[model samples]
Target: MRRFFYTIDSDNADAPLLPKLSELSQGSDIELPDSIIHHWCRVLRANVGDQGILFDGFGGEYQVQLQTISKKKAIATLLLHLDDDRTAPIISKIGLVMSRGERMDYAIQKATELGVTAIQLLSSHHGEVNLKPAQVEKKLAHWQQVAIAACEQCGLNRPPLILAPLSIRDWLAPTESPNNKTAVSPIVSTLSKDKYYQVLESAADLRLQMSVPAAGQPAKPEILETVLKQESPYIELLIGPEGGLSDDECQKAESVGFAPWQIGTRVLRTETVPVVALTTLLALYSYNK
Candidate 1:
């Protein structure tokens, strides 16, 4: 049974129809475009009367029956809108400072697959993907498509938001964008300069940093032990760029109440750390969920 997430606005409660929300249904007529028609006819090899599931992201899943198999488009009659209830647990958030080339793509894809509630792009001193506003739009579209494909492949019903990009200095400052729309406040930011807290699933919030271990500082702590012993709802995760975060930024994050955690001794590629950290956090988050 292949599941496809879609949006449709038909009043019929008997059968979940194909999403003609974009093309037809001005007053009850349903239609589809050639692109989608070709997808069903040629790619899926679907014939008239084939049945499949459709979801409109709003917790409603529908079953539709293929009705019209036109040469240019395929149309479906909606039958029923069943409730779909598989959304990821709301862990904190993950913000990755952008890096060059395919690594950024890889990071976004894996982060979505790992069930992150939201992903924030970071503009840092060592950042990549620096472009004009127009170019930014193109990149954003590309990243969003990556996220969508990830959701399709991973079977996560609720799509996580890829928010408008952010600057490290601005993000580290007192105010930030609201990742949660329905919340009373837009974001978790405040006017006062306070510790930037990002709640992730892991108890031990880790930041991939520039400093390596010296000879004798204690590795784990009592606080981490206590939290790890039970479970934590939110965590903070920071992954630096190719060159890693500067000393000043790390000090700033530390001053703002972030704990320093190291996964291992070897340096992980910028993109790899988030996948590792996020997947680790997902394990912990799922346990609590």
Candidate 2:
């Protein structure tokens, strides 16, 4: 299927440009935004009568056929709405401490492909990169774009939400009581002595003690299996920066019910950790289903 991604603009309420194609009908004339026209006509070299798919990133997608092509805008006739749900059964959110340059971009892209529900960018004591307030806004917008592009490529109907950057301490702070909230299995990738730890269904809300062990501990795949058996569908994952989380940071996370778990025998880069971790969890969840 030929699909294109667009973001909704708040200014134009009636025809909110490329992304929000709300008023679609079988024989209706839909005007494509300049950006969409450029990409579809100029970049993709799409001609009249070519079939195309459009998604607003809200949910599902639309099938259309190009009727007219021009430099100003292209027009397409809506065929039908697709109610396809491409979301994963499990709701996983990754708290990633920001890494430098393309590493952060790559991590966000891969994590979106793995079907994470949301990505919470974090700052930590041991984090190498620090961004100003202005820079944070720019980075957030950039990363959101990256996620949308990834979803378009991966056939994900809904792109994961990209939250603004916040400190790890603040992000992990207790908001409500566990009894009041749904049970969330918190997992942290850390250097721990117990490399072969298994997560039991009974220990769904267990708080694990933090321990520093040598690097190169292999990840236990059964942990994911145990998590999938739990009543709650949510999983909160914490991955540190290049230098990894400080001892204090680990303790703080442990205090908040995050269990320290190792992913591989050798240490993986900050960007590689989320991709590996999310892939393992999603694969196991899919297999069990």
Candidate lDDT (C-alpha), each: 0.57, 0.68
RMSD of each: 8.3, 8.9
TM-score of 2: 0.78
Model 1, residue 226: distance off in Å is 6.0
Top-scoring candidate (TM-score): 2
Error of 1 at 58 (Å): 2.2
For model 1, residues 11-55, the per-residue Cα lDDT tens digits are 234544444333323233245544345555678888877876654
User: Which portions of model 2 miss their true places by more than 4 Å?
Assistant: 10-23, 174-224, 230-232
Cα lDDT tens digits, model 2, 72-119, are 878898888888878766667778889988999999999988887777
List the pairs of residues colliding in candidate 2: 216-265
List the lowest-lDDT window of 10 residues for candidate 1.
Answer: 183-192
